[model samples]
Target: MPANNPPDQPPTPGQEPDRTIAYRQHNDQPYPQGYPQQGAYQQQGQPGYPQQGAGGYQQDGYQQQNYGQQVQPGYQQQGYGQQQNYGQQAYGQQAGYQAGHQQPGYPQQNYGQQPSWQQGSDFLGTGQPTAPPAKKGRKGWLFAVIAALVVALVGGGGAFAVNLLSGGGTQPHDVLPGDALGYVRLDLDPAANQKLALFSIAQKFTVTKSSFTGDDPRKALFDLLKKDGAGLDKVDYAADIEPWLGQRVGLAVLSPAKTGGEPGFVLAVQVTDETKAKAGIDKLMDGDKYGIAFRDDYALLTANQDQADQAVKAAPLSQNTNFSDDLNALGETGVLSFWVDAGRVASFAPELAAQNSEALAQIKNVRVAGALRFDGDYVELAGVTRGAQNLDMGQPEASKIGALPASTAAAVSFSGLGDIIGKQWAQILKSADQSGAGVQQFATQAEQTYGLKLPDDLTTLLGKNLTLALDSNGLDGDQPKFGARITTDPAKAQEVVGKIEKFLAASGTAAPQLAKVPGDGTFVLASSQEYAAELAKDGGLGDDESFKLAIPDADNATFAAYVDLDKLEKFYLQNLQGEDKANAQVLRAVGISGTQSGPDASFSLRLLFN
Candidate 1:
């Protein structure tokens, strides 16, 4: 909190942020100021660094920040290259965050790196820092088991599949805070949803907001699940937590235990299934020109249909065929299947087979039970023997939205049951809104509220998503900033597409190039990625060989402003250093340029090149 210094501090002992770059940069991308020199975000006990490791919060005025302890917005796990094997805790547990890298060991057992990494962790796990359980002795006929997928389906009866595409069971969508790649947990018992399940649910439930926002505000998105408005009205807490004033789908899991236990099947699912709730498959207002938004999640399953079908066929069920087409389909009428745990039904449940689905069951045992986020537009139905209460009904939980007329609620659910997860997710976001911190303050407050110590690493992921959402929402831009442009560029467009691959690899936000080209046209990035109009204007445009080829319309800047070295020097000498707040001034005007012609057409594009 020193007045002279910036918020981020230098690296500390053992807490140094990884400064080594494994690969060489072909181009010279300027590092943010004080970047390698180390800013305020260092770990504790590092060489030449100060001993500051509390909350990095200052009391009065002059205190060095403990970068080690400073909760940042995008803290991710660091990985050292591939390790020969799963070593003792020593090599695994480093003091501070390291950039996720592959270790040299683990030739036999695969180790997962954290979420941001793109390469193989050798193991299927991301570098999430989990202590995987030890493998038992190899069992006989393992290959035989692997070879029995299709036949297994015939034997087991449930047409099931495990999809590696759609990012391994995760529906294609903006990567949200909890969207880190992970394993599917299969469990059984009385159905009551939980957070993990709700997250899975959100991944599946897709909605068409007149205008959507966020990495994916699906946390409390299940409020749209209403059969007759009864489900949404079940819990009075939806409106308080959800966003956009939507309805709660009444998605909940009533499991057997009150504490740590495996998540059972989705106990109650009351999603609003509009759009016929199935793959449009050559059927659409646009004539199934690819599935619609609600159907997008299901459509992603196409990438791994073969593998998924094989997996599904291996699951136990009565009769199954849809397995071939809808590799993710798991439902009745002699058709059953198994699916990778991407938020559909949890492991198999054997008891509630007859209930098919609970209808108007009293909320007797409901404690607002935990929630799960379902991803994609797919159905999972397994035929286990049934008892009095049926557990696995994909009814969307009701809470993200509120007060829907029964019919309206059902309409919403049937049409956008997939999107219900979106509504449900909107609610979880409220937990961040408390005390104005919203998610930014979660690291400090979450311990008491959620009862678990969610580290800053995870909080940063959430905060970044929230920040992007808020920025896009224009609550900050309702009036609109005249300086920002809303046009596109071809070369920049290409950059927009490439950035996703880069960002996902490092979880680092890169400026969008397409937004920089000053013009009047729609730039299309990959179908999935979006562009930030403002940042694009700031990136500056380019007219290279590729640019002239793709950009249908291109014109020289009606007004141009190259990097003004003299003006920058004068401004810095005259106003910055002379004033105590020079730090802030330097941050605003450092190494950036802009050009303007029409009131809104011109932009800052030179920075990308020079």
Candidate 2:
């Protein structure tokens, strides 16, 4: 609990005592006392007001002295029959104490002398009705009002403190968050062409988040406010959510806590704001709304493939299976799939599955493939492509008016200009290529293994010597042998297969030996991927380099992940250390599958460390 400051003045009677809640909480299970029990005190039927005080009960015009009256200005006395048990005989005996008084008519007292005490139309002949006593006058009334206000403040404030300490809970009768204080705090991560640029923002933000209610809503509200941005080592949300403090929302209140001395309510609510959310993601990727511009291959691919309605993706089975599933390489669209606990993911209603229809449309064919465990009520999706090779671009590289360099092409939008990168985009020409360059990358190498060749020239690129496994026999198969075709240096592989060709070249040789894990059947690479992969092999990547390289900063949440490797082996030993990292530092050493092509994928870097 936070420390307390002293009150400006001493507490009054019946006020909530300081620190009462904390003390009471120490004995949380003590029985509650003094609830307004059901049917405690109510008029049995119609209300009635008989003549004066008890003994003076007038019975149809009979009057007498103050006979047997309990004399008093401020005291009450009990009667006989009330104390006696009622048997027929006991009832008769009790009746005898009543003193059946026959009142002889006595004239009422004359009020001329003490006229001030006498009730009159004209008070004390002052021509005005008698006013309240001076002690109960305006000054007295002022004192009363001030006293009342103080009581109320103490009650309200103290109750608020108590409620906070007790977990300001909603009661069965309170309005829900969507109904009371309404707003939302949306987070966004836009799509980069490939790889994802991590992003988040702290700009002022707002949404109609509501809450449920029951007890003292003020106390409940105060309690909730205290927790609004209370996070440690996480991005602070205070500046972003403080502004939407007073808005009222409409929603249902679900569960509330039991009521006692505290006051307040808890409310769960839904919120919405598409634009701010998108911008916040921009913050995470960059600082300002539009602070930086870059590319994200993972984002573009996922969005594109999903829009295209492709559904080949998969996520990890669980944490126990995380590394293996990642290396499995089942993702077809170049999508990198992994597991996130669906049961733990929580968010507001405004950020519903229905919000990103247009973005979702971009990847019409995209699918979130995974064992049922990794999926939630819903998950955003995106596509991926390993290199330009197995992609689905419809035109030839020189289709555009002018040529573009690889780094230069990264900046230019192909949407406005056609694929003029010429040989620059030869990889795109090959995915659905009828010349079967895609299949040839594998078969030609195979034919070479049998002592044949004379096809296209393949060389000229730098790449990291990293991959999960080697085999074209689909997901489940033994590692293929290079059989003595190539060397083991990854840098060597990248330097050789960097160029593209339209005419015949090459020869044949025995397959090279395949590399495998120390003990497991897990593989490093084989003769085929060495000959077939199109992405440059030497442009080394840092372990934490931005995978997205074709768009401005953004938060692209959607993905159609693919894991290429031996499901069993990749699940255990392989690792994909990001760019600029040693092959020895693989993210996870495991077996994997190979994609004719890979898809674009995104991930929240924060959770990775977690």
Candidate 3:
């Protein structure tokens, strides 16, 4: 490390340090200064330049700098139509540090032919290089990009709608995180949301001015109604109930039950003052009203009468520690959240329930929760899933999928692979037997068709844990590269490989190459020998910072996955057309993890954006 250089340590969370944008000015016995000091830079007040904020870019007072003998001539008009030129120096030319030194690649300046460029105002010394100006239309392009993001985020009115449904309150006072099978929390109050940098910046472009004027959202609603010729002028939401509006809101996905041929679910919200809330509701219902019920601070607002009734009858999250813990696993709190009760949902949703009864039965006992928060370059979403007693997450074996390489485009690891496959396979055979699709004769038919001895049972051929990963480097090639790592019993490993090879041969496909890595009987199956060799290398995601940040406690998780958002963006840009490619660039990375404790399991996903 050079003495004059700053520390190279990467930033810790919430600790972004200053990044040197310009070379430091030279001082003492010596060489000409490279650039001006902080103080001088602050005085520039350059337009379009970002001002210093609490966390970044503080400007100090200016200090004089020096320029040595390599000084070049100024200005040449390349004409406005071309990339803007800032005089003869080509805008980016600068003298080397040593006396009479000139940086390479720059055309030697001819003093005799030098054109006059603006002087004195240039804080950078005469010979010092100037920062290149932004390209034409760059600012407009950036604004458009940001506007698109804002519109997409605001689209669906879903942000507000979710908050409204879940009781958007500052505290989990009325309904605990566990009150519903799943819930989403969002900061819907315009004032509160604006505090967030994303919202704050977006608001600059958004129309903050309401039609009716003033700060009340009710007034804004009325004004909007009037614009549609609803004649809402007589309504006075402010006088009726604006005082009870809460800053934060939540939306909950309650346990499911069958209702009216549709999967039943309760959507609930929180009310600050029941009396005032009802009055406000009554006012809104003046034209057409839906049933509204209240329990404590929560308000049940759904068109489905039975679902609404069930919401009022069900146990609130306040009483369930499992549900609460699942929510807490996502985050103690967040701007917005979402949840799903796999078991409960499977019971009522006919489509889901119709899956192999065995598979559906296994899935029914799980509960999932997710949350959101604002963090560097990403709008993160965290999720959690819990499982039931009958469900197996391959506990004894657990998952030794280890870490994926940092560059992995996508990865998924799960335990209970054997158990799940075995169960599903059994169910398939049973259904086939009953449907006359094959049953007892299926195994023989499969063997004859594929010309391989098809095992009647699959559990014996696979392991408890499995990991599937893909790298970006592969997708661009003739065949997309992939890695499938499985943890099998050492005794059965050879037989398993043999079976797979035979199966592939029979199917008229190339056999996947494989390599054993150092872990609990773990081996890699890759699309090619090169990929297999690469998989044998170290640096599996185990120690990657991004992986750790996204999915902690991997060993305990029943399932985990990671997606390199940066790579995905690149892939999308290369393969996808239309606006989607542009929109895809916004994400940076995504990670998902799930852990089960007894009958309940929690799952979470973290999404990072650029």
Candidate 4:
């Protein structure tokens, strides 16, 4: 060990003394003025400290040495500027950490320079700075890509707009007779989105998916018709039907024939190729009692050749303003749509006219339009009917069922019921009797026994708005919690309730308790007083998410009904097993709502999915 070495150190046997300590001892002077303190290294070119070299930690003070290599007392190592040998290896020949020429295809990197990352080059290998490669032809390629995208978007958008304006494709009205009294059309090919939505929703349920076995719904339906024995036992769908069958099909009830028999009907089938369709029809009608006639793209089928020829000569239903207006008012047509001229149909059916002559007389003319639509979450059947003359249908009213408790599992409400009962009591009795139920006899006996008027008392009890609600709270018991609340004149409601209670007591029937709700002209007939009290409270059923989802327009509906299957499924499904239970589980709720505006009435019925 050398005596000049610091504590806890053993000097190399053949190495020179520590130069940093020896230099400071020899100078024996404080750091020069304007320079850093003793412990800090001086700036480059400052006296008493050596300038740093490219690869050396300190220049002209002590030479840089390889680890574990002994330094001779007077030996001086060269700086990076002058390459030299390290032991037997030359500086330029050392593989890594050497300040010299590099491997082929790589730039030379000086030792202790900034790393490659900061120099904008590959970091893992050399620390040399690299020039960025030119981005040749990128702008032109980018413009080409952008131009293609714009063209595709514009073309697709134009096609979509045209499809929407043209109503997707040809409709049944394009072929059926303009003067048809009744028409039912089925569109096996709906819009792409509608078809995809139907297919996606159908696939969620096993039973529905079975009916849609193929991507082409029309072919699936034709196959089903063949298998179901629809008088197509001898017809092969692939050979006879698929060759020319277009997507739209319609059945129309035409005017009575000139010979004055039953109303004639024609089935119009759209054809893609007239020649193929004619040949296919000849095969289908080989031994059948049917006749066919071709007009434009449609093949009309009738009972005989005369009827089919007459149908082709008439103006197409697409030109009928009444039919078009009615269907347009009903909004977008769905997979299945129908139109009915009520007066014309009634005039043809003498039996129906005779049975309801009074009711028919009120409406001079009526047109009905309806559609069956499918969505991802629900299936809806919607219809609209407009009458030339105002019928007994009443105005819409805000429903009180919204105030029912949130736990209500099922409810039905009606507005303008009192007026309906008052005006239609006689007709209702007649219809009831026609059904062979003896309702007139029962009503007469009830009036005599209770000493009450036929419909006047009944109307007073029913009132303007009536709602019936049932909850699952007590459904497990023998007597479920259920109640009916009616909006009526309080005094009249009380009198009618008293008369009804007395009538029930005299007849040896269990009587329900009836009472007027506080602060409102509403009366409740309930199985228990507690349920009646619940009916009176201003509850939040209207704000409940499930209620809103089920009955969206309940508040302003003339008539509405809702059932919460999610809440009641446990009780009803207790006895079910296997596929029935699984199918039932898919149903979440059901809702029906109807609105009337003057002579027009519209209604929707929806089945919601889980």
Candidate 5:
């Protein structure tokens, strides 16, 4: 169909002009041709070479020569097969060599298989063919190593994200503070907090939900820092020395011995950036006696240089045995921690000690430590008080303490209230006399009011383990119904209830319904006989899993209490309207529990909210 014919006059060998094949990407575009296209050639009957096409040889019968290969003698001249079917059988014949005769490592030629000429397949070489040049093994191995490194980097980054999301590791306690009557530490950046404080205060006038898109608490802080703590109206706190003007800072109340004269305090900051922190302090001091002292990266400031030096030289709070023990008991990583040396505080503040001498004397040997942690929907604060031998804060007992009924809204349990009451009876009587309750002569008053002879000593009716509870669970119709329950020795409880009944009869009022748990040693103070009877049938809180979770380790607890804030919040909200109701904040529950070892006591309060 297509025209193809030889030229009428073939050029003589020496007079032939050189020619080139040109390639154009589009019909309209012309590009100069590059290299001269050479024809392919193959020898017939060569052991590993392809066969000649159907044309066999040219009319002149001269042996064909390969474009770049040396030609062997006795081969017939041949034209190349169609290039579009390059890998197909040449002119209808298969390659000359049989499949089994392939070189030891050479790939077998298949139907339509392209010739790998660039792989240096030298057909002229001693009857052997070369295998594809060994792939760049070193380059492949290098790429594999790089791929592994990329995977490791990606995995490490993911791990870091997980750690940050899970609340990254806690640093060691701020050990810059020295021994003092009181010491406080916070796991926060003081500089950041100062910025946050300024931002929050300014937000009242300058910030609004629609205008501010960023929620990071530090954005405003950074802006405030740039402003040089200015623009705060009416005595800006940031303008003054933010004592906690560093990454970590603490306050310590040093005794007179360490303070040089007056009982003074020092603010110690862990200086992350010395230049910035120092500038802040300089602006605050303004030539006052309080100056900054640097110990390495830590900066201390106090009323005088001596106090600052004392804070630097004295033993750190981290090394204090009692304080560290208490800190561990509360949670080492809590947001805030504080310790109070009761003896030191009393000695430092003698004026207050003189006013409350008796009460102070009782707790003079106490060492108090507390910690605060803020979890989602929960704020927990725990305190530990380690007292000296003389304080006689009772020890735990093996027997179970009073267990309040499940319907209770709030309850308090204490170990041996009787012993403490007896020890402080005189102070108790004095306080009652001052209050007009006349408890100093309670026996006489009881006899006159109830027409019954009361025990001369009030301790006779008391029990070692006591529990008192209030029930407002039945609150409705804006009027809260209140019920009270007390647990102690069954015999002692009966005696006290009888005395109260007699007093009610003498007053000519309806006697309050009283019911007792059959074998649980608890008395229910109910609004009616029917309610009291109903209360006796329910299980106690001690058997409830939710109650146990609220107050854990009850066996060793010296005192424990649980408050159902949900019920309390509902009761209060029911009586409120409009803004009052909208602004009301409620917690899920609050559990306060304590443990006493010898004279030392530790207490924790767990507050849960919605």
Candidate 6:
């Protein structure tokens, strides 16, 4: 036996501490001096803590048991019923205190259940209990919103990557002759992302979307071809063309066999199935006018069998060094591309050769290439002319049109006009009049009638930089405000103005007003004096947001142009109605810019969208 007679004191040697006494002490309630007697403890199912009885421990709403008896069905026992046992009973469980099962009228809870005092119970003073605060509702909508954002970001990023990296398909140069004089290719089947973009952009307007009834752009084009005089009325697209037709088609103008013979052409069409393509061509063409021959993945169509055979036998355009180099300089080849061998073309055409022999001889090695590309917000047509040195246009200089007013509706600026006119006047006149006598007579007549030097006065008037601008404010009235500002010597410009005034007076026509812009070495010729003064003011057009968006590289452009479609829409679209007017409104502006570098020159024309 162990000694434990004291109240609220530690147990004696070898004696177990009573959990009932510990629980009561934890709640700041006094423990009995000795073992509790039967019926002396609190009544069963009371709100306060459990107490030890003489026969067994009991709590409110719990069954009584003798010390040596087994636990009742409504209660669980770990130590009290059998001898010398002392472990905690599971709380908030059904019947015998097992996990995940609840007792009668008791809320279900995990093993780490809090004591009654901390579980919203008034057992410390009022002897009553309350339910735990209701749990908060789950925030499912927040998670859903997060998931949607994640998907959008991932999907958008993937699409952007595909648009930049995807290659549409085989190009036309893959099959054309290496030494062809010129080539034009149309790519109906582009990359997946490009096709999707084209479809989406087209669908934005009511007019364009009407033709694109389905997702297949190629089918729509074939349907259109069948309706027009495309000569495909007898053929069925689903059964005849779609069976073997590929995505790309190219037309090449071959050089003449000798200098005087006429140039021939070869049409190369991409084909997936050669047998079907051959059969389709037989049905579509007459033997006397057209011929077909297959090489690699393309079917070559020509005027005759011999030309078709020869085109296939020749080296492909992909292998031509000059053609490849020029195309590579042009960057991405888009839905449409064209290449011209200037030297070969000039050599083949007798009329062009006779008219400008000197110019043609100098451009014997030059080539010109261009492409058209589409984007989500804009469409761009870009071109490049290689070997520009052979036909020297003039040194490129940046245009100074950015000083025009922000209200400018349209403007075109050019540099090096004087140099081109001064150096090429004689050659130009010779080309226009091979006999040379007619041009001489015209010059003499002009000089005699106007009393001014011919080319000298013209070159001085044009100067280095010339810009023509139309202001939006002028469009409100019958006579629109417009002017041309030219960079030149003020005194010389005034002299030219005087000569023009005299000529206008002699002809009995009204003379236009011309004056120098204050502080700047430029002259403005306008419809009226007030408009000329407005043109002289610093308007900061270059710094305007719309102008910058339209002409991104205006600072480096030798030649540049801008037109505000929004400002001009009222004049051009006033008569349009319904879908046509709405579709036409999609265009916001157009910008053109060009640059020249030694033997290479490039230009870009872009149409911006709303």
Clashes of 1: 152
Q: What is the lDDT of candidate 3?
A: 0.48
**Candidate 4 residue pairs in backbone clash:** none
Better of 5 and 6 by lDDT: 6
Query: Per-residue alpha-carbon lDDT of model 6 for 207-311, expressed as tens digits?
Result: 333221112334556676778877877777778877898767899998777888978889999899999998877766734478678887899999888888888
Q: What is the lDDT of residue 528 in candidate 1?
A: 18
Clashing pairs in 6: 44-60, 44-61, 45-60, 45-61, 46-60, 94-101
lDDT of 5: 0.47
lDDT, candidate 2, 181-255, per-residue tens:
111111111011111111000000000000011123323444455568433223233433222222122112111
User: In order, how many clashes per candidate?
Assistant: 152, 152, 47, 0, 0, 6
- Taken over the whole model, the C-alpha lDDT of each candidate is 0.23, 0.22, 0.48, 0.61, 0.47, 0.61
Q: What lDDT score is found at residue 69 in candidate 2?
A: 25
**Candidate 1 structure, TM-score to reference:** 0.16
Rank candidates by TM-score, best first: 6, 4, 5, 3, 2, 1
Model 6, which residues run further than 4 Å from truth?
1-166, 215-234, 286-291, 304-306, 435-439, 446-450, 514-518, 527-534
Q: Could you tell me the lDDT of residue 204 within candidate 2? A: 7
Q: After superposition, which runs of candidate 2 have C-alpha atoms over 4 Å from their true positions?
A: 1-422, 425-456, 459-561, 564-610
Give the per-residue lDDT digits (tens) of candidate 3, residues 1-610: 1111112223233321121111122222221222111111111233433333111223354321211111233422211111213353223322111112222332323222121111222211222223332222322454455544433233223132122113112233234324455555454432112222233233232221011011234345456677897755555766765655444445665443344253333445556888887777667667574656776566666665665665667665545655545544554234455556667666666655564676677676677766554433344555566665565444434444445565677788877767665655656677778677875585776556643343423454456777788877867768888877666664565555666677678768976455444334666677767766666554467676666667766767768888777776654567744434444455566787776555655666676544
lDDT of 1 at 73: 45
Q: What does candidate 5's lDDT look like per residue over 1-54, in tens digits?
A: 000001122223432111100111232222112111122343444454444322
Per-model TM-score on C-alpha atoms: 0.16, 0.17, 0.55, 0.67, 0.57, 0.68
Q: Residue-wise lDDT of candidate 1 within 10-34, one digit each (tens)? A: 2233422222111111222332211
Please give the distance, in angstroms, between residue 591's alpha carbon in candidate 2 and its true position after superposition. Answer: 15
